[model samples]
Target: MKANRKLVAAAVGTAIAPVLVLLSPAGIASAHGYVNAPASRQAQCAQGTVSCGQIKYEPQSVEGPKGLHSCDGGNAQFAELNDNNKGWKATPVGSSVAFTWKFTARHRTSNYEYWIGNDKIATVDGGGQQPPETVTHNVDLKGHTGRQTVLAVWNIADTANAFYACIDLQVS
Candidate 1:
């Protein structure tokens, strides 16, 4: 009888092991962040300023492998962000723009990069620490004028992944 009970206990543990792993943080895509101020593409979708599909619901989930240049983070659900003619509202700003980020799930970060075309405008080191709920970086947009798209990347320190946000701007 004791042997049968032990066998049942082992079976239950085996059955629930996969579920437990799924419930673990490491088992899920944990890092979530997005640029908020100046209204990034995902931000516009989340705020109803633009029409989008799945990305509209989880704007902060545009995460993929690091060193990617795509605005959607290579996520098919956020492919609308890659559409240049989607009528994404361009925020008007001066040469210096402060880009704010909102993090849903904070992770140790490596750095934040801002790019305009092939030019890297700014790179703020994260110092391998978890950031606050909201972080802002003032990026100089000098030498850039008129309509432009800024790609912002948040590279995670501990993971080989990064969060992406693309901000459209009408710079002065």
Candidate 2:
């Protein structure tokens, strides 16, 4: 009877192990990367400039499938990032501003692209090499001005997905 009980306990543990791993923070941490400077929506939450849920813990992990442009990275847990009414502070930036990215797990990059209000503003070709801990690009705002949201994308060189970071800016 004791042997049967032990066997059942082991079976239960084995059955739940995969579920536990999938729900672990390490699994989420693998998502990687976010805009650090200029404070992307997730960054603000992570820094306590804004109150958020799970994203506040792993701000660098607000990732989603590529080709979609959304501030929350399509992760509903980070949907707070999509909330415009949260009073997300917009950083004042010049026409040519330097944007920085913080990566927890750096992957090979195909390119970096930036968009402001439906217009593609800048694209930096990142020759299929892993970036440093932090990467910065000087984006030319050109004719854009006033308040705007900058959507930055880091396209993975080997994967079909990309990480997205959206920053609210007061461009001058």
Candidate 3:
């Protein structure tokens, strides 16, 4: 009788072990980040500067697989960001611009890349270390002028994913 009770207890423990592991903090450490300054489309949406859909509530969650040049990180909920005709307000900037990023969950970072069309304008190395709540990068846009959509990517060090944002700018 006692042996049967012990066997049942062990079976229960085995069944619950996987659930505990999935609920652990270590198992759910995905990083969330987005560009705020220069007011990326997500930032503008979050701040109510522009009308948006579900992405306005979770601007920092525009994460997707790396090497993607998309503004919404290929997220269906954020697909509104890919619409260039949505009347997004462009920030006036100079030949050189400073972009500020805000992270809701900072993780070990790989690097940050800024792109204009097919051209990569700037890259800031992270050396695989965890970052602060906010980071700023100064990007040079000397050769490019007028309205441009700059795709910003935040590559994670330990993960195969990255966060993405797009800043609309009217360069003078």
Candidate 4:
């Protein structure tokens, strides 16, 4: 069957290149997608620790073919995230990229563990003063170029289930 008109147009839009962000969060690291997090486990920007991720993606689109499409097609997927880390993804644009994030302790994520691609990204997990903080990083995504979606998941170190997670993807 022929593709829907809107979907075709959207696909063209993605191929042509428009600001495309998956708004998702990673892989090979036991990172679960953010949508999986329980609503009660939701982390407040002002109460939890913040980890940021920078991402880049192959040609995709915010406006792309809808309905069952291929991986190569622009997808509205919530980047997978887990308690292992927190971050944001962005496509290499004109010059630089920016990131801002926070994690709250109020979610009872006792002993929260955080990392950024193998680096310790945070100090406190779920205990202590529930610090509210922010960090900024800039990177050139001219390489590793593909759909870059940062992942952030929250779960007790010894626990199997995650409590909170989030991802912010910037596609261009």
Candidate 5:
């Protein structure tokens, strides 16, 4: 039985070896999160309320103008699960936005969700979190155009250094 198990392990390792080779050192480093729109500040808002930008996949360094911020500032706790998955949220507060948020697990979030004016209309999923790395991130609020109340959340709680984001988006 042990010999059979060894053989199975070897076979699995061999199969996985080819797949692991494609992940560069940088790719491995990015297993935590990704930085979206490092230079651009304007992310589109559909329904004129739900706009987003500079989504960090694994809590990386975010850079923008002084007023531009994404996620909160703190270490991510295990309990901050339902918040924004390293992305920003927008809700039209007299053309701005607002939302309640918390923290989440590292590299565990499958995607993100947003609600514009009480209607949950968007979700950011598998375009980048998977292995291929060719996924894209964007949203279109053409159909559910309504009043928006940005609901932004992130992962930050009971952690050594809390992971956070600036919960604001430059809507267009």
Candidate 6:
């Protein structure tokens, strides 16, 4: 009888192990997304254009609560992205360019917004659908020139969160 009881306990542990791992922080961290084109700060880190910490491994995981304007996506683990002196490479772009996002986990999106400093230059309505593996938007940089940093926000439709990506650019 005791042997049967021990066997039952072991079976239960084995059954729940997968569920526990899925619900862990590491699991959720693996499901978020970030910008890849124009090569966002995190993306640059991931691509070795810049030296970074753990953010270099999970470039898509810089997600945070929505309505907040921050490059790190409010995650301290990725805080290095906010450092301007990290020698982040700026891609040369025209006045109008396509900014693309490579999503590892696509969520229902509310919108995509782009900013240079405090000015909002463009916004694209997301239509509340799961994005493709990659989404691209045409952003106008009309009066902007020289070295500039653009902040892109991917607002999630069903959650109080968003993903942020900062891209350095040399607009010509």
Best by TM-score: 6
Clash pairs, model 2 backbone: none
lDDT over C-alpha atoms for residue 66 of model 4 = 23
100-163 per-residue lDDT for model 4 (tens digits): 3233222233443333334434433455233244323343334323433332333443334443
Quantify all predictions' global Cα lDDT against the true fold: 0.93, 0.88, 0.92, 0.31, 0.35, 0.90
Q: Give the TM-score of each candidate.
A: 0.84, 0.84, 0.83, 0.25, 0.29, 0.88
Stronger candidate by lDDT (2 vs 4): 2
For candidate 6, report its TM-score: 0.88
Clashing pairs in 6: none
Q: Lowest lDDT 10-mer window, candidate 3?
A: 24-33
Clashes of each: 0, 0, 0, 27, 34, 0
Question: 2 or 5, which is superior by TM-score?
Answer: 2
Between 4 and 6, whose lDDT is larger?
6
Q: List the residue pairs that clash in candidate 1.
A: none
Model 6: per-residue lDDT, tens digit, 60-101? 988999876789989888888899999999999989879999
What are the RMSD figures for all models against the true structure? 3.2, 3.3, 4.1, 18.2, 13.9, 2.6
Which candidate model has the greater TM-score, 4 or 5? Answer: 5
Best by lDDT: 1
Task: Tell me the lDDT of model 2 at 45.
Answer: 87
| Segments in model 1 whose C-alpha atoms lie over 4 Å from true places | 1-31
User: Which regions in candidate 6 have their CA more than 4 angstroms from the true location?
Assistant: 1-8, 11-29
